[model samples]
Target: MKNVIITGTSRGIGLELVKCFAEAGHQVLALSRNSQPVSDLNLKQVTALSFNLAEATDFETVKAYVNTHWKQVDLLIHNAGALVNKPFSELTPADFQNVYTTNVFGVAELTRVLLPNMVKGSHMVTISSMGGIQGSMKFPGLAAYSSSKGAVITLSELLAEEYKDSGIAFNVLALGAVQTEMLEEAFPGYEAPTTAAGMASYIFNFSLTGSTFYNGKVLQVSSSTP
Candidate 1:
C-alpha cells in the first residue's frame, strides 16, 4: 500500500479523497483545520490531523509526525484552498493575500517540508480550478481565487521541472465546478455536474498511476462547464 498525504480533509473533495485512499488500503495522512470528520471515520489506515495551512509553521507538526511515522510518501495531494468571492471593486488586498496564502504559499511550504520524505517515483497533485486555467471562461467575482489557483498551476510546473531528476512527478488538475460547499458558496444556485465523491475517485486513481505516464501537465477535468 502507498503512503499518501492529503490536505483539507475536513469535508468536501478532501474528505472523500481520504475515504477513497483509506478504503483502498493505503496509509493516508489527512490534514485539515478541523479533523473531527476524518477522525470520526475511525479507519485504521487513516491518520487524521488538525492543521491550518494559512500558518506556515503549522506544517512543522506535520513534518515531525511524518518523520517519526513514515519513511517515504508515495503520493501527496495539495487539495486545500481558499475562495474569496467578491467583485474586484469590493476586494481588498488582504483578501487577495489570504487566498494566496492558503492556495499557493501554504502548498509550497508544506511540500518543501515533506520533500525529503517523498521517495523516488512519488506523485504530487495540486487541485486547481478551471477558473485559473488561461483562456478558460472567467467570472468577475472569482478574481482572488482564480488568480491564486493560476499561480499554483505555474508553481507545479516549475516544481515538476526542478524535481525531474529526483523521479518525483508533479501535475496539476484544474477542476471544473464540483458539487461542494465551497462551490455552492462561490456560485449560489448554480448546479455542478460533478460530485465530490466522483472527483475524489478520479483524483485517487490518478495519484496511484499518473506519475508513470504524466508529469508537468495541467489537465482540465470536467463534463459540463460551470
Candidate 2:
C-alpha cells in the first residue's frame, strides 16, 4: 500500500492513525516525543519512534529514521501539537515557544526536511483546529494554542498553492475537539474530544479518492454535542 509518516503517534489521533494504516497494510513510521511502548510483536510494516518535537534539531533524527528505513513516503501527517490554557498575561514566552515549537516550527521543519523524498502524488495532512477558523466562546486561556493552529492553516494553504503544479496534495483537518490527553489536560473534564481512529480512516480514504481536486481544502471536525 502507501508508505506513511505520522507525527505525535505516541498517543491520541496520531496513534490511532498509525494502527489504522498498519492494519490496512501500509508501512507506517510513527513518531512521538515519548516512547509509546509498541508491543514489538514483529509487525513488519509498522514502527514507533520517539523524539522531542519542541526541539528544531530533533528533525534530523526523524530524517535519519526515514532515510535509513524507507525509500519514499507516500503520506505525511502533521498531528503533533501542544495546547495550554491560561490568561494571556499569565502565559509566558516559554509557553509560546513550546507551543509553537511543536505546533508550527516542528511541523514545518519536519515537513520541509521530508518534502524532497515525497513523490508528487504523495499527500500531506495537517491537523488544525476550529479555534483557528473563527473565534468562539472557546477562548479560555487558549491564545497560544489557537494562534499556533491558525498559523498551521495558513501554512498548509500556502504549501498547497506552492505544490499545485507538482501534484502534491496539502490538506488541513480542523478538528473541533478531540478527546485526547492534550485536550483533557488543557480543558479538564471535557468529555472525549473526538474519535481519532474514525477520523484517521476518513482522512486516509478521502485523500485517495479523486475528490482531491479540492486540494488545499480545509476540513473541520468538532463534537456534535456540547
Candidate 3:
C-alpha cells in the first residue's frame, strides 16, 4: 500500500481522491481548509489536515509531518487548486498572485520539499483543465485559472523530462468539465455528468499501475468530447 498526500480536500475532486486512496488500502493524508464532515467514525489510516494550501509555509509543515511519521510518500497528488474566473480587464495582479500561489507555486514548493524523501515507484498527479491547453470561449472569466494551469502543464512536462531516469513519473490529467463544487462556483451554467467522487475514483485507479504511455503525457477528459 502506498502513502498518498492530497491537499484541497474539503470538497470536490480533492475530497474524492482522499476517500479513494483510503479505500485502496493506502495511507491517506488529506489537507484542506475545511473538514470532510467525518463520514467515517471508524477513521483508520486516513488523516485530515487543514491549511491554507496557497501559503508557501504549508510545504515545510507537510514535509515535516511525513518525515516524522511515514518517512516517505509513494504518491503526492497536487489536486487542490482554485479557479479565478473574471474578465482580464477586471483581473488584478492580486487575483493572479492568489491563484498562482495555490495552483502553481504552492504545488511546486511542496513537491520540491517532498522529493528528497519520495522514492521510486512514486508518482505525482496534477489536475489541469482543458482550459490550460485550450482557451475557454464560454467563460472568459477563467483567464487567471487558465493561465495558472497552463504553467502546470509546462512544469509537468519539464519535470518528467528531467526525472525520466529517476524512477519518478509526472503526469497531468487535463480535465474537461466535471461536476464539482468548484465547477458550479466558477461556471454556474455548465452541465456535468461526472461528479468529483467519480473523477477521484478514475484518478486513483488510473495511477495504480506504472505506465509511461500516459507519463510525461497530458490526458484530457472532457464532457464535450465524443
Top TM-score: which candidate number?
A: 1
* Model 1, C-alpha of 40: deviation from truth (Å): 0.9
lDDT tens string, model 3, 1-226?
Answer: 8888887887788877877777768898888877554234245788777667666676677777898889988888888888777788999999999999889988788888888877777888888888888544435788889889889999989888998888888888888778887788787877788878888888887676634456787888776621
Q: How many angstroms is residue 63 displaced in model 2 relative to the true structure, after the best TM-score fit?
A: 1.8
Instruction: Give per-residue lDDT, candidate 2, residue 68.
Output: 88
Model 3 spans > 4 angstroms off = 36-42, 134-138, 210-212
Which lDDT values do the candidates have, in the order given?
Answer: 0.92, 0.79, 0.79
Q: How close to the true structure is residue 186 of candidate 1, measured as C-alpha lDDT?
A: 90
Off by over 4 Å in 1: none
Q: Positional deviation of 171 in candidate 2, in angstroms?
A: 0.7
Over 4 Å off, model 2: 39-42, 135-137, 223-226
- lDDT winner between 1 and 3, please give it: 1
Please give the RMSD to the true structure for each candidate, in Å: 0.8, 2.1, 2.1
Candidate 1 residues 1-226, lDDT tens each? 9999999999999999999998889999999999999999998889998999877677998998888889788899999989988889999999988899899999999989999998789999999999999999998899999999999999999999999999999999999989999998899988898899999999999999999999999999978776
Best by lDDT: 1
Tens digit of lDDT per residue, candidate 2, span 112-212?
Answer: 99998888788988888888886544566889999999998999999988888887888888877667778777778877645767777776676555235
Residue 114 lDDT, candidate 1, scale 0-100? 92
Better of 1 and 2 by lDDT: 1
In order of appearance, the predictions have TM-scores of 0.98, 0.90, 0.92
TM-score, predicted candidate 2 vs. hidden true structure: 0.90
